[model samples]
Target chain A: MSNDNEKDWPLWEVFIQSKRGLDHKHVGSLHAADAGMAIENARDVYTRRGEGNSIWVVKAEHVHASNPDDAESFYDPADDKVYRHPTFYTMPEGAKYI
Target chain B: MELNEALFQFCLRRGDDTHVLSHRLGEWCGHGPVLEEDMALTNRALDLLGQARNYLQYAGQVEGKGRSEDDLAYLRNERGYVNCKLVEQPNGDYAHTIAKCFLFDAWHLPFLKAQLDSKDEQLAAIAGKAVKEATYHLRHSSEWMVRFGDGTEESHQRAQQALHDLWTFTGELFETDEVYTTLQQAGIVPDLGPIKEAFDRTVNEVLAEATLKRPEDEFMASGGRKGQHTEHLGHMLGEMQFLQRAHPGAQW
Candidate 1:
C-alpha cells in the first residue's frame, strides 16, 4: 500500500553505516512519503545483505549544496590553505589512530 | 499420526502459509502503489519464500518420502496443502494486504518465540532465524495499519473495511488439530494459547492507535487446515504451479 496522496512525495538520500566506527555514507536515493517510510525503504533497499549497522536518510531537498558555477572562485581560496591539511604537521612515529 | 509424522504435517502447514502469502505479495511486485512500496512488498515476498524453502525442506526430510522441497511444493494438490484461508485471500487492496500481513505477523512473532523452546532443535533454529524477520514485518505492517487507519477519510474507510473483511479469517490461525496436539504434547511444538493472546493484544493496540474499531467477533471462516480452502487458493495455485506442472522437473 502507498500513501499516494503526494503525487511525488519527495526524494530521500540514503546513508548507511556499515559498522560502528564507520560513517553513514551516502548509498543512494529513493522516493518516500515521509521520514519513516524513507528509512524503511532505505533498510530494504540498501541494507538487505546486512550491509549496514545504522541508517540515516535526509530529504534530498533539505541538503544544502554549494554552486558548482562558483567552483573556480569559491574553492580556489582553500587550495592554498596547506596548513588546513593534517599532513602539514608531522605525526609522531608511534601514532596509531592518527 | 505418530509424533514425527504429525510434526511433519505441521511443518508443511507452516511453510504453506509462507509460500502462499509470499506469492500473494509477489503479485504486487510491479503494481505497487508506489515505486518504494513495490520494492518493499517484493522484499517481504522474498523473505517469506526464503523461510518457506527452509521449512518445507525440513518437512520433506521428516516425512521420509524422499521428495525434495521442490517436489513437495510444486507437486502438492489443493487437498495436500495446509495453509490458513487468511493468507490465501486475495490482495484486495493495499489496506487488505497490510491487514492480512499484520494479522499473520502478530501470530508469527509470538509463535516463533514459543517455538524457541521446541524439543525439535532444527525447528527451533529455523524459528530463531524467522522470528527476526517476523519482528520487522510486524513493525512495517503495524505502521501501515495505523497510517491507513488514521490517515484521511478515504484511507480510514479503506482500512476499516479491510479489517472488517479480513477479521473472519483470523480465527483459523489458532485452529488446532490432532497433529498439533501430538506435536505439542511431544514438545515438538509450543502451546498456541500464548500466541493467540499476544496476537489479540497487538491487534487491539494497533487498532486503537489507528483509531479503528475492531470488528465484533461474529462469524469466522475455518477449514483451511483440513485442506479445505476458499476458491482463492485454487486459482493462486494454478498460477503458481503452472510452469512446474506443465514442465515436470524443469530446471531454471
Candidate 2:
C-alpha cells in the first residue's frame, strides 16, 4: 500500500548558468515525476530572478563516477606533469593587459 | 489630463495589480504541499514584486511626485488600489491557488505581450521586460492546472471545483474601465477587447487540455478596478499593511 507513496519520483540534479557569460553550476536536486517536470521544477527553484540563462536537469542515477581509491591513478599523474603546465613559458617584456 | 497623467495612472494600475497579486501569492511561501511547488509560488511572487517596483517607481516619476514605490504600495487605501478582484482572493488551498493563478496568468501574459508595443516608451519597455517573466508564470501555472485537473480522482474533483469557484472573478480582468478607455484613446495602452479574445482562446485551450469544462451561466464579479472589492481585501490589507501601519515611515 505504501509502495505507491514510497515509489517517489526520481531525483534530478539541476545545473544553472546565472547569466550569459557564466558557467553552469550544480544548484540542487529535486524529485520530479518525469524529466519535463524536473526541468520546470529546476526553473522554479533556480531561476526566479532572471538569474539563469540556461538550465540542465539530469537524473541523478545517470551520473557516472570513478572510485575514490582510483584517485591517485586517475588524477595524481597529471599533478606532476610539469611539461603539461604553461608556467614554464616566460612572459613578454611588457604584456600590458595580461 | 496630460499624457504623463495618463501614463501615471496606467502604471499605478499595473503596479497595484502586480503588487497585490504578488503579496497574495507570497502567502503560499513555505506552505505549499510540496517543496517544489512552494518554491514555484514564491518565485513567481518575487518576479511580480520586482515588476511592481519597477512600474511603481516609473509611475512616481511620471506623476512628478516625491513618493517612493513603497509609499505608493503601503500608504494607499483600498479604494485607491486598482488591481482586479481576482488577485485579492484568498489562497484557499493548493488547487485553489493554482486555479486562481491559471486564470490570471492566462490573461496577464497575453495582455503584457500587447503592452510591449505600447505608444508610451516606458510602458513598452517595462512590458517588453515583463513579458518573458509572465510567460514562465503562465507556463508553470498552466502545467500544474493540467496535472491536477487530470490527476487522481480527488485531485481532479478539487481542481474542477477550484475553477468553478474562481470563475466569477475572472471577468474583472477583461472589463474595460474608464482608465483603460482613456488610455486607449491616447494609444498608450492596448484595447483590452482584443486582448480578451486572446485570453479566452488560451484559457479554453488549457481547460480543454486539462479536460476541465468551462464554467457556465454565472454572473461575473466586477468593481475591483473601480475600487469596490470583496470582503477578503480588508483582511488581506490589514495583514499586509500591519508593518507600515504600526510603525509609520519606520524603515531599516
Interface RMSD for each predicted structure: 2.9, 3.7
CA deviation > 4 Å runs, candidate 2:
A1-7, A17-25, A48-51, A69-98, B1-6
> How far does residue B212 in candidate 1 sit from its true spot (Å)?
0.8
Q: For all candidates, state DockQ relative to the true structure.
A: 0.59, 0.48
* Cα lDDT of model 2 by residue, B115-144, tens digit: 888888888898888899899998988898
Ten consecutive residues with minimal summed lDDT in candidate 1 chain B? B32-41
Q: How does candidate 1 score on lDDT?
A: 0.91
Residue-wise lDDT of candidate 1 within B68-182, one digit each (tens)? 8899889999988899999999999899999999999999899999998899999999999998989999999999999999898999999999999999998998988899998
How far residue A61's Cα lies from its native spot in candidate 1, in Å, is 2.5
For candidate 2, lDDT tens digit of each residue in A1-98?
A: 12465767788999998877667899889988788899988888777667788999999999888899999889988987889877877999986545
